[model samples]
Target: MTTPLKLTEEYIFAHDLREASAKIYRASTKALLKHFRTTPIEEIDHRAVLAWRKKILENGLSKRSWNTYSNHLRTVWGYAIEHGLMTHTTINPFRKTSVVPPKRASKTINGEAIQRARNWLTSLVGQERCTQERTQITPAWFWLAVFEMFYYTGIRLNALLCLRYKDIDWDNKMILVRGETEKTHREFFLPIMEGLAPHLCRILGEAEKIGFSPDDQLFNVNRFSRHYHGKEMNIDQVESIYRKLTDKIGVRMTPHRFRHTLATDLMKQPERNIHLTKSLLNHSNIATTMNYIEVDYDHMRAVLHERSLAQGALSRVRRVDSSGTPPTSAITAPSAQIRLPSRKIADPKPTTLQPPQQQAAIEEVIIDRPSRSSGPSALRKALEFASAQLHSGSMESATDSPSDQIDQNLLLTLMASGLGVGTFRKRTQSERSMGSTSFSRASP
Candidate 1:
């Protein structure tokens, strides 16, 4: 005869959750209580739970919100079954009822907007207070410290609010995060960075002057608010301050956006250590940290630009001709030729040959080279030089060394296909003689 409301109250009491977690749990169960008030836990079946889910969507609640509420209820039901509040045969209707929410890209705050807000806060920090103020320190200085801590450390709003004076270790330069304040309920430590140390020290000095004990909240609300003077500042009051600043800066500002911005900026660094960023942000899983980062297209473009082919080592094009002289009538000058270091090759033995046979052999070698469909203009010029050499009858008078002739053919192949010549094996004497005979018969 136990009801969901009674079970939820018992579950909350048994678990001893933190204030924030307990508040969320109460709110989640409140939604269920609206639909199933006074209904027995054994009588509420899957159909009733489905009807409640439909009503939530009808009320304009998002799938993400529906999932969150269902998760809390499901956990409560599981706890009831474990504690013998519910029958072992009874089914948990809330289990496996969540739908995957559609993913939306998270927009990061613009760097210029953040800079403007920081500048505004800095100006406020420097201003002198009027005589009417009760405290010597202005509220702006306290808010400035909070703003810098959010920017530099990227701590969550809840954890930041829960921070105490004793958590800071000045000698170790670290701040201990309590498990109760963390979303994952795990204790961890964060380093006090160089840029953030000064602001923290200033705030600590002010807190000491006010005689705050080690267990008291680090950020004193008393400096600014008369109502919350002795009490710790809550989320709504902090959000109200950000909303006012958003209006002044013409850009929306929130505590979570600071976490997103810091995560993205760290990812854009040259090292781009994602694991390090996860550790800094105190994320339970690396995947959760990944969702916080936004792609920096400009930085990606700069990296890709540096790898372009036009600016690479192979950009300079050279033409190789066996005649060792530039063609005058048939071939035009190349656009440019950059001198590159050449490797030495052993000279080959001289081979005697008839003039006609030599001319036909050179022609066959030129025609046998692979065709390039997308060859550069330099490759076209090389083919033109070969035609000029054949028509000008310069092959008979050529006395180039065998190594020079082989290098000429290798270079022509390289220019045509943009491939390295190392893989192209040299033709043997028998292969050259065969090519000469084949070209001699085919000549018109």
Candidate 2:
């Protein structure tokens, strides 16, 4: 029999994180209960509580929000038991309940798309329309700068927004952020990307022009929301500026798109160090980093190319070959498995005379062969070389003699181009799977 005013005030004093807890409690017991037939706290059972949670979750509430609600209710129920307001037999509904939140859907952004977004941002600066007046100096620059900072540092949006001038070290290309702004509440200095140095420098220059102290915020952003007095920037404001520029410049983009794009972009370079990438992304585990990264498209393409070359699927018919003078449309490429009896040329052959040039072509010349070693060092070097060429898109000359084993790229390529491999005997099996689209538009 508690009134909303008395219950809210009394409960808030007992809870440590009073503000957010009170909001959640009011939403659950007051707002939510109004929607249901169940009237009193004593009458509300575990099933009823779970049903409320299910309603909120099905309405697309975040896990963070759910946790807040559950924690608040747990506290309130505990308070009741502690004061003997309810019997001990009156079970706490949410105590052992496991909330298995649905996995959040992710969006994909490729390198080409990221570049287009960046280009639009650059175009936003220094433009004029209609009369002789300069174009609107909106938050596009701030959003772009923020986006570049987000991807380049892999810092959280909250952390990046809170960055002060003193936090950055331009000479070392590093920034020191507070732990409070971070998701983990453990701040680490991150290096700014060299590619984005110029843009960041421009921001610093503007801050300097405005005579900002090291302690002050680097930019006067956030006028889009919160501050009703004059201005204060927020997420929607940042996105609105970005969206306007994107629509005008014809680049499909959003802030989170930059983060996803960086993950994919880093995977593009085979020489990319995973350790460096993990550190940059500030991920706790290597597995989490792997989830965001994708297989390099260039690597896949090279594998396809190798298969095409190996399978003799393609031939370059030059103008001379195409001419009707006395030509074959195709010059046969080599098959890796052209076996012959081990009869040496030096074993004596019944020779017939041929043209000097034709005789030169027929003759086998082994010129200046390198000495081979059986040591581990030599074996290691050979393995390294093979791995480098295979991964780095360097293929052995097609005209060169076939080795004991084919390159793995050539193997993957051949498989894609209809080669029967060891396990995936069906050709073009893997090539058909060009990844999946992450999001789909729902009808409005």
Candidate 3:
């Protein structure tokens, strides 16, 4: 019977996973086999897997770390069942396991931390320039450029370390992240930020002076190595230097923190769109990019408060009136105490009250005429026509008709009320006070 370890080896060879992925899976599988203690492939049941999980957790393995191992075991078992190495009736033990990974802690580096890293790098470059007897530049300049690229491009540390001079487009100011080198396994281009361009140029100058060619890696481990033989710095050595610098500066950080810092800083721009920030970070899912952004609730509340203040100001402007009272047109009239203009029409002509005997005679003459259903409106129109005639200094045709009588009646009725006859009739207070004598005399 084929053992679990041999089946796992077959699966690894068949899948042809990338070098980094294969390495991780092989390590995960090796640890699992070590725990199995010569158990057959088909006999490792869910109970055994559970016990193994407990053992690892007891040994200080986090749930997330154990999940990685369980995930690899599941993949290998899937391959075994497919290839007939294990019976199809057997259930995969890893399928029955549950491991909820903990929430990711914030890896964001602040501006002060970035500045300190840059200052440390700058001091290193100065030290190298002063103490080094050789004319060629030291590794400090290369490390500075590496950190600057990390801040600007937000590429993974491995991708940045592996960048070749040919990957950069000098004229176009863009850098190509090869698909093979990227964690996503897909190629993409990133624009060279203007701030990082000078550092890149300086590195290139130093590389050229040291007999480097266009095909050579942008940053090599030549100066750091005792033999001075140019070799690409592995990820571990790069991380070691980063750790030392951060520890010395008292700003504890990792290289990956720069990626978080870039994403967060870009998203904070007032004019930045969320999708644009996602693309800048090269994130496949916008939710992943969002995890890096820390919104300021206090700032948002302040903006909303300012908006409300502006709206209140506009409401006050609408409430202003010439009389210093609230406008009647406001949304809530009761609150503002606005008064509407009176609707009762004033009489069109003014005169003193006539005596009972004379008033009765005038009413009989006007009321005895054939009454129209539109009484007040017809009388009002007749008064308006006569007033217009008086103002223009014109008279109607000489023919005496019923229409003329109606106009005369309207004038008499208006005179009985208290109103002026348009602009044509103007009487002084003395004339008005003289009562019927002056009023009759003034009438043409």
Candidate with top TM-score is 1
Which candidate leads in lDDT? 1
| Clash pairs for candidate 1 | none
The TM-scores, one per candidate, come to 0.66, 0.51, 0.62
The local distance difference test score of each candidate is: 0.71, 0.54, 0.65
Instruction: Order the candidate numbers by lDDT, best to worst.
Output: 1, 3, 2
Clashing pairs in 3: 349-419, 350-419
- Which window of 10 residues has the lowest lDDT sum in candidate 1? 435-444
Off by over 4 Å in 1: 88-90, 105-107, 129-138, 224-230, 297-444
Q: Which tens-of-lDDT digit does each residue in 271-326 have in candidate 1?
A: 99999899889899999999999888999887787776446533433344465554
Which lDDT tens digits does candidate 3 get at residues 1-444? 677668778887996466788777888888887888788766678888999999989999989889888888788887787777787446777896868878877677878878887887788788878887432224677778878888888888777777887888879999988777766777788898888999889877776677676677776766343535646767776787778777777876777888887777786678758788777777788988888786656667978988977766433344345655543332222112222322221332332222232222222223223233445666566556544434332233334432223334445545444333321222323233432111121111
**lDDT, candidate 2, 387-410, per-residue tens:** 443433323344432221222333
Q: What is model 3's C-alpha RMSD?
A: 15.0
Question: Which residue pairs clash within candidate 2?
Answer: 222-232, 222-233, 223-231, 223-232, 223-233, 307-413, 307-414
Name model 3 segments beyond 4 Å from true: 82-85, 130-138, 223-230, 271-274, 290-444
What range of 10 consecutive residues in model 3 has the weakest lDDT sum?
435-444
Ranking by TM-score: 1, 3, 2
